[model samples]
Target: MNAPPRIAAPTHAPEAPRLRPDRAEAGALTRLALPIIMARIGLTLMLVADNMIVGHFGAGPLAAFALGLMLVQTSQMLGLGLLMGSAVEMAAAFGRDALDEVGRIWRRALAYALAIGFAGAALSQAAPTIFLALGQEAALAASAGEIAALFGWSLPPVLVYVASIGLLEATGRPYVGVALLIAANLVNLGLGLLLGHGGLGLPALGAFGVTLATLIARITLAGGALAYILLLMPGRQALGRPRWSDHRWADGRRQRRIGYAEGLSLGIESGAFASMTLFAGWAGALQLAAYTISINLNMLMFMVAVGIGGAAAVRVSQARGRGDPAAMARSAATALLLYTGVMLVVGIAFLALPGVFAGFYTGEADLLAVTTPVVAGIGFLSLIDGAQRVVANILRGYGDTWLPTASHLFAYVAVMVPAGYLLALGLALGAGGLILAIALASVLATGLLLARLVQLKNRRS
Candidate 1:
């Protein structure tokens, strides 16, 4: 019944030296981003593995898995984004050598994460209604709803892991999360096979079993991460113990505000994409299954940008804490530069071998046929999508919150949703049409966000 504590005033420190994208600074950014990139990819691979596993079972289960996952991921992104303020604040604190404040921020963030996670789990219980309201067939909705509710149980543990990882990442210990994620992935793969396919004297539970495996894996990740930080992490003493003073609601308003803007922005963007899946669903099960594979692949590639964006946020937040606008500019520029080169390579691969990539998800020729063009479309989409992603994080790093949310609203909701409806349904373009709408939205979103970042840097400079 106690209110959360208000934020303590910032402890000022002397401004650090200006940093350039010199070899050392760039090297530092690379070192931080690489593990994060691997970790993000590892997280995505778990979903990819689930799709691959379930896809072999038949298109019905795959479609249901996709439907459930799309819904769960929207909620997940909202929670993840809401919790982002933890990393932003902690990184700034670390930059100022305000070690105790970092601990306080983490504690507040963990509470926020748990609250959002539980809320999401509760909402997920209504999946059948949501899908039915969206106009899906009764049978598909029922199957997908079961999958959604089952997978929903993992949200709490997953967010706990996110809160812990955010603190670790902010404090320059990114590798710990990576190790935990790798272990979790291995466990998921093993359990997925055993439960999903009827090995080890158990009946095949299909999608339900696969989801149960994920739930267990997520709990393992949460527990392992908490254990390390609480008992075994270096400087555990400096992390400090939680106190009632740190729990007052009024004290944590600023952190919660950042989380609010981020959660809404991420929710809007993800919800728009989920709508596209619904549109594909209306086109029939074949188109829906194909769209799922294609979009999942796009997300896999997007993780690279997410990693760089995360690293950029930290570097820029650190620069901000040090009162170094020029360094912030350089860091933002460096992240954009790296993101561009990496996306170019990924785009080329997607375009050159779309079928090869599609083949990884399903061996069915009909599904592959429907999915290939969409995969190729994503190659173009990633270029634009990745830019917006990096710039949005750069804005977050600089403490500009609500504007990015507004931009996503305009671009993804205002632009992408109607375009998806028209292109995919109105024009009968099928799954490929859905992807084209995403590209169109990304083009607009990227332009708007890039302009905003430039405006901020110009004012600061």
Candidate 2:
């Protein structure tokens, strides 16, 4: 021992710990987010294309399409929120290694989405008279009615598409969902060109043709996603075989609870937006048309932020399932930071060239005059909205949905709508006042949501 002491004394230092992030989690978030972002971009492009063609045709067509979309989106928001909430639930189950439970949840969610979609479609088709009752101009009401009729036929397929995409994303195969959306969009674009403008010797069907193309694309994408889940990726640990028996009320009670809360929350928020548009309509047709154009562009940017927030939900839910609150908090923070950065860039770009962006949708001088202030308002509001969305997703990931529902009800219903009407109609600030109210409400909501997220995170800690 003494002879070997000199050699024995030599000790190697401990190896430095490698700083590999949780690769699976990181990869999962990136894979899920990128596809959603790309798909949203494609959707935005379609919107731009629609606006371009419709604007070139005339103000009436543009206004009709915009109003129709506003109504359709208000209905669709609830459905989409339900699907998204269900996806988070399934993803959490997958993280807990409960594969069968994920399938059970998915089946129930899909059933709900289908039923809701069909019912919505029927209502839109059967109740064109309802638009007349909303105090809209006679001409505007009739135009909206026609657009709603076309939307009715498209709702089921769109619902199916949304449900399938939720399932796929929950099962850690979001890329497949993205691919299907891309393919569908490509087909839609080609068909839209053929039917919308009568290219390729096809009949020009105008706005109705655009809706038809969307319906076909939705059906194709939904069918393809269903096939992939049943045949190609059936054996994944995250998605077991679909079980009809698991599609029971008892099995989906928790999911329904969360999904309904999420849906109602989003509906309240969207309804606030609808109210703003109504106020703009009261100002005049030109104001409505202009605000619609600017708001559509605003939503396109907002969707990018939303897609990122959705990815945060998946990542945070997975971490929570693994009992790692720290990782969950960090993931959410990262998502918020990323969203803020992106929104800053977008805000600056919009601020610098509001007219340029507005030009893509309309060339009407009167419309542009109203839209400029509205667009400027959005430039500031986007930052608040983008940040709040991320925080809201974090709360959702942790299964604290009811709080947000209450927050939206209070913020939007109790504050935003009344204030907007007073400012726009009562105070005669016109479209500018309407937009200002939106900005104010958004700021309030963002603050509330951020505070709630902090509290939730601290409690978990």
lDDT of 1 by residue, 344-436 (tens): 888899999999988888888888888888888787788788788888988988888788889899989999999999998999998888888
Worst 10 residues of 1 by lDDT: 13-22
Candidate 1: C-alpha lDDT = 0.86
Model 2: clashing residue pairs? none
* Candidate that would win on lDDT: 1
Give the least accurate 10-residue stretch of model 2, judged by summed lDDT.
14-23
Which regions of candidate 1 are displaced past 4 Å? 1-25, 96-99, 320-326
User: What's the count of clashing pairs in each model shown?
Assistant: 10, 0
Give the TM-scores of the predictions, in the order they appear.
0.91, 0.87
